[model samples]
Target: MTDENARHAEKMKKIKAARDRMMETKTEEKGLIMVHTGPGKGKSSSGFGMIMRCIAHGMPSAVVQFIKGNWDTGEKTFLRERFADEVRFFVSGEGFTWEVQDREKDIAAAKRGWEIAKEQILDPEIAFVLLDEINIALRYDYLDIDEVVEFLLYQKPRMTHVCLTGRNAKPELIEAADLVTEYTLVKHPFRDGVKAQKGVEF
Candidate 1:
């Protein structure tokens, strides 16, 4: 028993030393362009989680919802009401492609949304901006990817973090991003004839 305990203690000590050494090389403290893309859910949820963190730290946050109709989502309503002064929220999409059924209008909405999004992102006071479903817009070619990436490169503030969340993220946006996370769908109740619930799916 004594020998086993000593081995465990030595292993933990080595692990801690290695971890501390690796941490020493990480000296960056600036905003990041994070992308969350996949077929599964939780892309926007994770982006909203970042907004929650920003709000907790007393930093302002903005949300530009693209390719998603303005639903009465709990998070949206809560943030709009609770942090009215600290957050700016906008929904620029009428609905999904199947529902919208018009290419010209879709393009127009995307252009309008991107315009609003740029306004929020260029504001240095807002520490976090969630470009919800922006990837979908790019996938449909509703907005110019090169223009978006250029704006992100030259206009973003040093202390402002931007989160782009959706499926089918463009290659250019992913390459320009500082962090990328892909969520794989393993199982979902909707496949089993279950509808999207109020709190969970919405």
Candidate 2:
């Protein structure tokens, strides 16, 4: 081989060795508590991606939508149609707070949503639980952060992974999560007077 080819192969050999060493160190397996929060979008989208992944892996999964109403979403439709048995989907919101316009009603919806989440999370058969838009509920005090954290600590199945998604996540919840992702807002079409598109926003 030429000198350039030989150097490229040597660099790749070292890279492979480093990657192997890193992979060798990740041997422990435990249920993960993930928080996806911030002002930007894609928080629920990312959690839905994981739900799809769980379905692909034949793991039972569930969704409890806290702040999103019974709007027809593409992900929900697809998951319910394709893998209905492995996925249990629930929508427990009347809409956004401004749209709902009733504090007590919103609180009731949040409580109902959380009750469903508690059921799915405690079910050992359900390996993944997506608490969709729950962060917004916590931010609005519709749900108690301390209570949620306590349940996650003591009630959730040991091997069940839980994902919370929405903006303004509570610091206590963030501290309790094993993984946290904050979606920073750089640019959004809504700021430019463009409405949410069919497949992109919903």
Candidate 3:
């Protein structure tokens, strides 16, 4: 063959091989639920780490701070300034359950926050959702486990990711989750009358 014809033939062979490889490789999308529980300080911290990882990969994330509505964590402030519209954070006006003791009011606040959570959980743009302290709310009967599970199963966008953190995680949640981490409390500063610090515990 002539030089021009030989060059064209080589280009055609390369194109054919590329087409075959593209046909052979395929990608499937799926979602995941990660639970961080047990009596420790890093449950929410772990969830936030996952959020940062997702964002680093150009994935959007949302955070729903349930029981810790009033207490301002550094993560919340950082997210507010950096991500702003990308992260959706909803905090109930009422603080902790022990402080409130108003069953009706606490439930009402949780339900409202859960409704907002439901929206964030289903949104396709929100690749990862940090449900900070959600397991504790479920354990305390502030939210319905079945309802949350059903929503996780049904409402999640294709390839969406979820992270839940709190203590005393129920068996059902553990079973439903793809990854579960239990942070055992071997040692903590709070036991020695150390109050929650600004950047650490808040």
Candidate with best TM-score? 1
In lDDT terms, which candidate is top?
A: 2
TM-score of model number 2: 0.93
RMSD (Å) of each candidate, 1 decimal? 1.5, 1.5, 9.8
Q: Model 1 over residues 9-116: C-alpha lDDT tens digits?
A: 999999999999999999999889999999988998888888888888899989988877657787778888988887888988887777878999999998999999
For model 2, give the RMSD to the true fold: 1.5
lDDT of 3 by residue, 39-108 (tens): 8778988788787787788887888888887776788888888877667667753677888888888888
Q: Compare candidates 2 and 3 on lDDT and give the better one.
A: 2
Clashes of each: 0, 0, 0
Collision pairs in model 2: none
Worst 10 residues of 2 by lDDT: 67-76
Report how far residue 130 has shifted in candidate 1, in Å. 0.3
- Measured with C-alpha atoms, the lDDT of residue 45 in candidate 2 is 95
**Rank by lDDT (best first):** 2, 1, 3
Q: lDDT of all the models against the reference?
A: 0.89, 0.91, 0.82
Misplaced by over 4 Å in model 3 are: 1-29
Distance from true position, residue 81, model 1, in Å? 1.6
Q: What local lDDT score does residue 114 receive in model 2, on the 0 to 100 scale?
A: 92
